[model samples]
Target chain A: MQHALILIGVLIAGMGLSVEAGLLGPLGEQVGHLSATLSIFMVGALLLSLALVFTPNRQLGTLFKQPRWLLTGGILGPVYVIVLTLATPLVGVGMTMVGILCGQVAASVAIDHFGWLGSEQRRVDGYRVGALAMILAALWLM
Target chain B: MLLPFIFLILLAGGAVLAAQSSINGRLGAKTGVIESAWLTFIMGAVLTFLLMFFFEPAHEATLFSVPKWQLTGALFGVVYMLAIVFAVPRVGTAAATVAVISGQLLMSLLIDHFGWLDNTVRPLDGSRYLAMVLLIGAIGLIYLSHQQRHRRMVNQPG
Candidate 1:
C-alpha cells in the first residue's frame, strides 16, 4: 500500500506538472519566451520563500546547509522551464509533452534501479521494464 | 518538422532530470512534504540562475521586464505541487498519473482552443485532438501494465 501511494504521488505530481506546463504555455505566448521563463522561476522562488515564512516547521538553514545538492536540484528548475518553453514553441505543447514523458520514463528506470544522487534505491524488475516499454510505445504513437 | 521533434526530446530530458531530483529530495529520511517542496524549488532555482548567467538573453530587458499577468501562473504551480503531494498517497502512482494527465489534456485543449491566458486564438483542430487522443491512450497502456503487474503479484505466493 505504501509503495502504491508513492507511485500515485509521483503520477499526480507529473499530472500537476503537466497542467502547470499548459498554463505556462499560454502565458509564454504573451510575455516574450525568455521573460516568461525568468518570471516563472523568479515567482517560484518568491513563492517558496513565502511558504517557508508562513510555514514555521521548515528550517531555511537546512536548505542552505547543503548548497551543492540544492544547487544541483535548483538548476533543473530553470533548465526544465527553458527546454519545455523552447520545445512548446517549436513542436506544440502536446508533442513536447510526449517527448518529456518519454525521457521521464527512461531516466526514471535508471534512477530507480541505480539510486543515483542519493535517491532511494527502488529495484527495477521485469514489471518495471514492461511498464517502461509501454510508456515508450505510447510516446512513439503520440 | 525535425526541429520540433528534437525540441521535444530536449523537453523530455529536462522533465526526466526534474523527476530524478524529486526522488532524490524525498530520499532524505526525515523530510516532510513542505521540506521536500522547498528543497526541490530551491535547487531548481539555483540551477536556473546559473543557466541564465551563461546563456545570454536575446532581449536585454528579459529579466527585468516581466508583466503582471504572468504572476498568476505561479499560483498554478503552487496548487499543482500541493495536489501532487496530497494525491499521490491516495490513488497510487499509475492511476494518479493517468487522472492528472487526463485532466491536463482536457484543460490544455480548452486553453489552446479558447485562447485563455492571453494567448492568440488557435482553434482546436483535428491534428491536435488526435495527438491528445494518442497521449491519453498511452497513459491508459501504462495503467494497464501496472494492473497486470499487480495481478501477478497478488497471484504469487508470499
Candidate 2:
C-alpha cells in the first residue's frame, strides 16, 4: 500500500513537472524571457506564502535560521528556471530537459551516496555507479 | 548565444545539486518543505533581481512592462513544486524525473508544433520521441539497479 502510494506520488510529480515545462515554452513565446522567469518565481513565492498562511506548518523562523548548506541550495532554484528557459530557446524544451535530467540523475547518485552539503551519507556501491553511468549513456544516445 | 547555453547547463546542474542537498538535509534532520520552499523562492527572487540590475538593463526594464497574463507560468511552478515534495520519496528520483520529462516532451511537442502561444513553429519530430524512449529506459534501468542494491543490503549480515 505504501509503495502504491509512492508510485502515485511519482506519477503526479512527473505530470506536474511536464506541465510546468510545457507551459514554459508557451509562456516564453508570449513574454520575454526575464519577465516570464520573474513572474513564475514571484507566483511560486506567493503561492507558497499562501500555503504557509493556511497550513499550521508555517515555520518561518526555522526556515530563516537554516544553515549555510541548506541556504546554498536556494541558489539553484532561480538558476534552474533561468537555465531551462534559456535552453528551451537553444536546444528546444525536449533536448534541454534531457540535458537537465542527465545532469540531475548523475548528481543525484553522488548526493545520495556521499550526502554532500551537510546531507546524510548513504552507502555507495557498484550498482549505484553503474546505474548512473547507464543513464548518462542513454541521455547521450537520446 | 553560447553564453546563455552555458549558463543554462550550469543552472541545470546547480538545481540538481541543490535538490539533492535539500533531500540530504531532510534525511539528516527534521525539515519543513513549505518553509524551505518559501526561503528558496525569496532568496531566488532577490538573487535574480540583483542579477537583472547589474547585467541586462534593457531586459530588466521590460519585466515591469509586461501584462498580467504573462504571469501564468507561475501557476505551473506551484504545481511542479507540490509534485516534487509528494513524489520524490515514493517513486525514487530517477523514475519520478523520467515521468516528468515524458510529460514535458509530449506537451512541448504540441505547443511547439502548433505554435500554441503565437510563437515560432518548431514541430515535433523523430528525434524528440527517440529522446523520450532513452530517458524512460535509463530511468527503468536505474530503478532496477536500486532494487538490486536494496536486496544485497538486506541479505548482508548485520
Candidate 3:
C-alpha cells in the first residue's frame, strides 16, 4: 500500500519534468538557454527558502557535518543539466535520452546491489533485468 | 572519437544523477525534505550563475524580457526535486528512478503526439504505441517484484 503511493508520487514528479521541459524550451528561447536554466534554480531556491523559513525545526546546519560527499547532490544536479544540454545538440535528443536511461538503469542497479549512498541492497536478478530491458527497448522506440 | 567520449560522459553523468537522487533522499530523510531541496537549489543557483557569468554567451533576451507566466515552469522542478526526496526513502532508489523515468516517457510521448506547448507535431505511430505497452510492462514488473518482496517479508519472523 505504502509503496504504491510512493510510486505515484515519483510518477507525478516525472510527469512534472515533461511539463517543465515544455516550459523550459520557450523560456530558454526567451532568456537564453543558460540563463533560463539559472532562473530555475534561482526561483526554486527562493521559493524553497521561503518555505523553510515558515517551517519549524530545520536541521540545515547538521547536514553540513554529516559527510561532505552527501552534499554532492547539489553539485550533481546542475552538472547533469549542463551535460544534457551539451549532449542534446550533438547526438540528438533521442540518442542522448537513451544513453541517460541506460546509465540510469545501470547505475541504479549497481547502487542497489552494492548499497551505495546508503540505499538498501536490492540485487538485480532476471526479473529486474527483464523489466529494465523493456524500459530500454521502449526508450529506443520513443 | 569525441562522440564516444561524450556519450561516455553522459553515461557517467547519468550514473551520478541516480546517485544524487539517493544521496538527496538520504539527506531529506535526515534534514527534512524542504531543507534538502533548498540546499540543492541554492547550490545550483550559485553554480549556474557563475557558469553564466564566465561561460554562457550573451543572448538577446533576459528573464524579465519574457512573459511572466513562463517563469512558473521552474516550480515543476521543485515538485520533481521534492518528489524524489520524499519517495526515495520509502521506495528504493531503483524503483523510484524507474518510476520517474516511466512517467517522463509517458508524458513526453503525449506532448509530442499532441504538439502541445508549441512543440513540433510528431504523431504517435505503431512503434510508439508499442513503446507505451512495453513501458507499462516494465512498471508492472517492478510493482510485482515489490509485492513479492512485501509478501516475503510479511511471512518471515522478526
Candidate 4:
C-alpha cells in the first residue's frame, strides 16, 4: 500500500509539466518562449531556494572541484521548456509528444549505453533494445 | 516537407528530456538532490535571464495581471525535477523514466479525455487504451531486463 501511494504520487507529479502546458501557452504568447522560460526558472528557483533554506545542504563551492559537467546540469530544464514551447505550435501537441518520447527513449538508451554525463554505464542488451522497440510502437499506437 | 523536419527537431528535444533525469540524478549523488536541484535552477535562471533580454518586451505587465495560478507552473517543475533526481539513481535511469512516463501518459490521457484545464474534451477511445496497454507491456519488459541484469551479476563468481 505504501508503494502504491508512492507510485500514485509520482503519477500526479508527472502531470506537473503537462499541466504547465496550458498555462505556458498563454504565457508564451504574451512574452515569447525565452521570457516565459525565464519566468518558470525564476519561479522555480525561488521556490527551490526557499525549500533549501530549511534543508541541510552541501556548499556549492565544492561543486567547482567536482567537474564542469555537474554544474552544467542546469541547462537541460530550461532547454526543454524552451524547445517544447517552440515546437508545440508547429507540430501540434500529439506529434510533439511522440517526438519528445522518441528522442527521450533514444537518448536515454544511448546515455545508459555510453555512460555519458556521469551515470553508471549500463549496456544496451537485446532485451533493452526490444523494450525500446515496444515503447516506440506503443507511442505510435497513442 | 518542412513539417517533417520540424518533427525531427522536436524529437531531439524529447531526447534531451530523457537525459535530464540521469544528469541531475548524478549531480544529486554529489551535491545532494535538493542542492543539486538548487544549483541547477541558479544556473538555468542565469542562462534564461540573458535569453529573456534578447526576446525584448517581455510581457511583464501582462504576467502580473494574470491569475496567480497561471504562474504556479514552476512549482511543479520543482517537484518533478526533485523527484527525478531522487528516483534515477535508486531505480536506474531507464526504469525510473519508465515509471515517470507511465504516470505522464495516464495523466495526459485524462486531461485529453475530460478536457481538464479548459482543454478540448476528446473522448478516450479503444486505440488510446491499447496504446497505454502496450506502454505497460514496454515498461514490464524494461523492468524485467533490469531484474535479469541484477540476477546475472549476483550469480557471477566472487
Candidate 5:
C-alpha cells in the first residue's frame, strides 16, 4: 500500500517533468539552451534555500565529510538534462527517448543487481528483463 | 562514429540520471531531503552558470527579455528533485525511475495530442494508446516483483 502511493507520487512528478520540458523548449529558443538549464538549477537552489531556512538544515559538518563521490549527483543531474536536450534534435525525440529509457532501466537494474551506490541488491532475472522488454516495446511503439 | 557517440552520451546521460536519483536519495535520508536537494542545486547552479557563461553563444533574447511565464518552468524542476529524493529512499531506485519514465511518456503524449505549450500537435493513435498500456503493465510488474522481494526481506528470520 505504501509502495503504491510512492509510485503514484513519482508518476505525478514525472508528469511535471514533461511540463517543464514543454516550458523550457520555448525559453531555450530565446535564451540559449544551457542558459535555460542554468535557470532551472538557480531557481531550484533558491527555492530549496528558502525551504531550508524554514525547516533548518541537518548537520552540515556530517554532509561535507561523507564520501566525495556522492557529490557527483549534482553534476549528474545537469549532465543528463543537457545531453537529452542536445540529443533530441540529432536523433529525433523517439530514438532519444528510447535510448534514455533503455539506459535508465539498464542502469537501474545493474545498480540493484550489484548493490552499487548503497542500494540493496535486486537480481537481474527474467522477471526484471520482462519488465524491461515491455518498456522497450512501449518506447518502440511511441 | 559520431552517431554512435551521441547515442552513447545519451545512454550515459540516462544512466547518470538513475545514479543521481539513487545517490541523492541516500543523501536525503542522511541530511534531510531539503538539505540534500539544496546541496545538489547549489552545486548544479554554479556549474551550469559557468557553462552558460563561457560556452553559450550570445542570444538576442534573454531570460528577462522573454515572457515571464516561461521562467516558471524552472519551478517544476524543484518538484522533480523533491519527488525523487523523497521517493528513492522508500521505493528503491529502479521502481522510482521506471515510474517516472512511465509518467513522462503518458504526459508527453497528452501534451503532444493537445498541442499544449505550443508543441506541435501529434494526434494520438492506436500505437500511442498501446504504448501507454504496455508502460502501465511494466510498472505493475515492477511493483509486484518489488513487493515480493520486500516481503521476503521482512519475513526472513534472524
Candidate 6:
C-alpha cells in the first residue's frame, strides 16, 4: 500500500515536470534559454536546501570526493533544459518530447546492457530488443 | 536517413538525462536523496550561471515585470525531482520514467492543442493520439521484459 502511494506520487511528479517543461519554454522566450535554466536552478537550489533542514545530513566533503564522471549529472541538466527550450518552438512540444524520449529509451538500453554508472547489468534479450523496436515505431508514428 | 540536427540535439538531451539518473542514483545512495539533490542543484546552478554569464547574457530587466506564474517553473522543477526521488525507491526506475513520460505526453498534447504559453496550435490528430497509446503499450513491454528476466532467474536453481 505504501508502495502504491509512492507510485502515485511518481505519477504526479511526472505531471509537475511536464508543467515545468511548458512554463520554462516560455520563460526562456522571455529570458534566454540558458538564462532561464540558470534561474530555475538557482531557485531550485535554494528550495532544495530547505529539505536539508529536516534530513540534516551534511556531507559536503563526501560530495567533493566523488570522481568527475559521477559529477557530470549536474552539467547534464542545463543541456537538457536548454535544448528543450530551443526545440519546443521549432518542433513543438509534442515532437520534441517524442524525439527526446526516443533518445532516452535508446540510451537507457545501452546503459542497462553495460551496467554503466553502477546500475545492475541486464542483458539485451529479445524482449528488450522488441520493446525498443516498438518505441521507435511509436516515435515515428508521432 | 533523415538526420535532422534538431532531433539529434533533443536525442542528446534524453541520453544525458538517463545518464544523470544513474549517476544521481549512486549519489543518492550515499548522501541521501534530498541531500544529493541539493548538491546537484547547487552544481547545476553554478555551472549554468557561469555559462549564462559568458555565452548568453539575456536581458532580465523584464523579469520583475513578468507575471508571478512565469516564476513557478523553478518550484515545479523541485517538486518533480522530489517526487522522482521519493517514487523511484518504491516503484522501479523504469516504471517511474514511464509514468513521467506519460504525463509529459498528455500534458504536451493539451498545451500544444491550446497553444498554451504561446506555443503554435497543433491539433491533436489521429497520429498524435496513436503515438501516445503506442507509447503506453511500450511501457507494458518494458515491464514484461523485466518480469521475464525475473522469472528466468527464479527458474534457474542456484
For residues A1-142, write the lDDT of model 1, one tens digit per residue: 5544544455445545545665665555554554565566667667867777788676555644553653354455566666676566777766777776666555555554575655444455554555555445534543
Judge the docking of candidate 4 as incorrect, acceptable, medium or high.
medium
Docking class of 3: medium
lDDT for each residue of candidate 1 in B69-130, tens digit (9 for 90 to 100):
54566666655555554443333333344445555555656666887655567786776666
Over B42-106, each residue of candidate 2 has an lDDT whose tens digit, in order, gives 66677766665565435333545656555566676666555554555444444444445544544
lDDT of 4 at B103: 66
The reply for model 5, stretches above 4 Å from the true place, is none
Candidate 2: list runs displaced more than 4 Å: A1-8, A25-31, A81-99, A118-142, B1-29, B59-69, B86-99, B109-131
Q: List the lowest-lDDT window of 10 residues for candidate 2 chain A.
A: A1-10
The positional error of residue B133 in candidate 6, measured at the CA in angstroms, is 2.1
Could you tell me the lDDT of residue B43 within candidate 5?
A: 88
Q: Model 4 Cα displacement at A29 (Å)?
A: 2.8
- Candidates 1 and 2 compared: the better one by TM-score is 2
* TM-scores of all predicted structures: 0.65, 0.71, 0.95, 0.88, 0.95, 0.82
Error of 5 at B66 (Å): 0.7
Give per-residue CA lDDT, model 2, range A1-142, as digits (tens). 4544554455455555545655555555554555556666777888888888987855666654655565654577666766666566666754665567767765655555565544444455564555456545545544
Residue B132 accuracy (lDDT) in model 2: 53
- Give the better candidate number (3 or 6) by DockQ: 3
What value does the TM-score of chain B take for model 1?
0.63
The superposed Cα distance between candidate 1 and the true structure at residue B30, in angstroms, equals 3.6
In terms of DockQ, the best-performing candidate is 3
- Runs with alpha carbons beyond 4 Å of true place in candidate 6: A1-9, A56-61, A84-98, B1-9, B85-96, B113-123
DockQ of each: 0.31, 0.40, 0.79, 0.59, 0.78, 0.59
Stretches > 4 Å off in candidate 3: none
Cα lDDT for residue A58, candidate 3: 83
Window of ten residues with lowest summed lDDT in model 3 chain B: B149-158
- TM for candidate 5 is 0.95
